[model samples]
Target: MNRMQLAALATVATLFTACGSSSDTGPQPVAIDFKALVGTQTFSCADTAGYAIGTGTLPWIPKDFRFYVSNVRLVDAAGVEAPVTLDASVWQGYGVALLDFENGTGNCTGGTVETNKSIQGTVAPGSYVGLKFDVGVPTASNHLNVQAANPPLANSAMYWSWTTGYKFMKIDGLINRATPFTFNFHLGSTGCTLATPGDFTTASCTTLNVPSASFAAFNPTTQAVALDLALLFAATNFDTADGGGAPGCMSGATDPECAPIFPKLGLPFGTTPAGSQASFRLVTK
Candidate 1:
């Protein structure tokens, strides 16, 4: 009961130590594939229709589509949160990325030759259950001068100015049967304060307007994140403008035009939405 028992116990202890070290060591890096889609269809610069979104039945031909997302996170199967490491590039900087599907073609006159359809990043390998991200730029970076800001932030089309900051999201299209013939949806932080025209040390916006999106069972590798424009406008009449006379929602709290669209953007009539209520849907391709 002495030497044999000691040797057996020693072997078991060594085995347990090895297993524990394996579990605690660094896991392999996971490649997260981010894709943007419109319903089941692939969203691109080309013309497509049959978008039966809102009660109104006007066919939509997309001319431009772009949006910003930051603080991207993934919840592993173990319920551990892991932030994504964005690939360094013009379209991505400071943990933010701009998803641009338009390539300055057709009616996309305000765009450029380059377009970013998706963004890829790395995370610690694990079985992820959900994904979370913010729709707009954080307060610290929102008020910076566009010319001096990072790549995507420096892009003029995305910036309203140093005072107003950037456009969180922009989706524009032509409504086939609408009277106005256009549907433009732009979202950004409002109610911002600046000491001067473009002051860097401006006060935080009353309406931060950064709606957070969370997805359950979102696979970072096999599945793609989708934003269905049809659902976004399912209740909107693109042909008509609100009392404020905007063709579509433009992040204005009082704009009646935004009444139907704001909820979809995770923003209510006059307040930011709860973190869990995002308008974006996940699509697998």
Candidate 2:
């Protein structure tokens, strides 16, 4: 009785150990790095002036730079994709994240000391050869009340109000000239309407304005995503302020100033077709 009982217990313990070992490998942490750049050089908040940009190569003082990234996915060598389940935190939550490049220094007065430089999350344990994500918050997440929203969404600097929803991206710069003026590129969904006067939960926008990108050769460990301000403003005139929604593009469908900028975001404005998104590109970390 003693020999048989001991032998049976040892066999059961071996099976349990093997099961535990297999179950231990559930998911792996995946982080895709990103950077804000002004062409070849990495961007810094201390540089207040003299960044060459725009059609005429005019100098401008960079003020603010922040944007959201969502629906992150990792792609395999054979083109199969898997969504990265984002870890909830102050900089990321509810399927969205704020990639803040400003640190409240120099001319970036509206920025905060805190900054987030990467999309942090986990994916199914496998080999990923590429990355893909959206450049804005989704509709269900975007059309909610900011006061009642979660982490990154509650960041007032990245928000507008109830009716208009959150700003997808906010990049501003003051044209360095005799009559210096601020050019705000506040992008969000426009042509929205709420069933009730102040109920943002009921708001529906005609234009979603969310741009997407897929990098076929991205290696999360050895590469980084670069958001190039120089490429963004390449086709835009920094000096001119069209008589439209704001001094610069405000995601307004009919704003002439927004027409050129939206295409740079890989978004279509008015009747113009969507141009290739030149603002985002790959770079070595």
Task: Pick the TM-score winner.
Answer: 2
Model 1, position 107, has a per-residue lDDT of: 71
- Pairs that collide in candidate 2 are none
Q: Estimate each model's TM-score.
A: 0.80, 0.87
Candidate 1 structure quality by residue, lDDT tens digits, 115-200: 77666565554445677888777877787767778788887888866345888888877777635466677788778786665555
Q: What is the C-alpha local distance difference test score of each model? A: 0.67, 0.79
Q: What is the lDDT of residue 77 in candidate 2?
A: 73
Q: Candidate 1 — which residues are off by over 4 angstroms? A: 1-31, 48-52, 124-127, 176-181, 195-198, 271-278
TM-score, cand. 2 vs. native: 0.87
What does candidate 2's lDDT look like per residue over 1-285, in tens digits? 477765554443333221212122366666778899998767777887658788765576778999999988888778999898988899998799899998999888978998889887777755567788999888888877787887899878888773457888999887855577788898887778887886768788888888888888876656789999888888887766566777777776677888778888888988888866778999987
Query: Which residue runs does candidate 2 get wrong by more than 4 Å?
Result: 1-24, 162-164, 195-198
Clashes of each: 3, 0
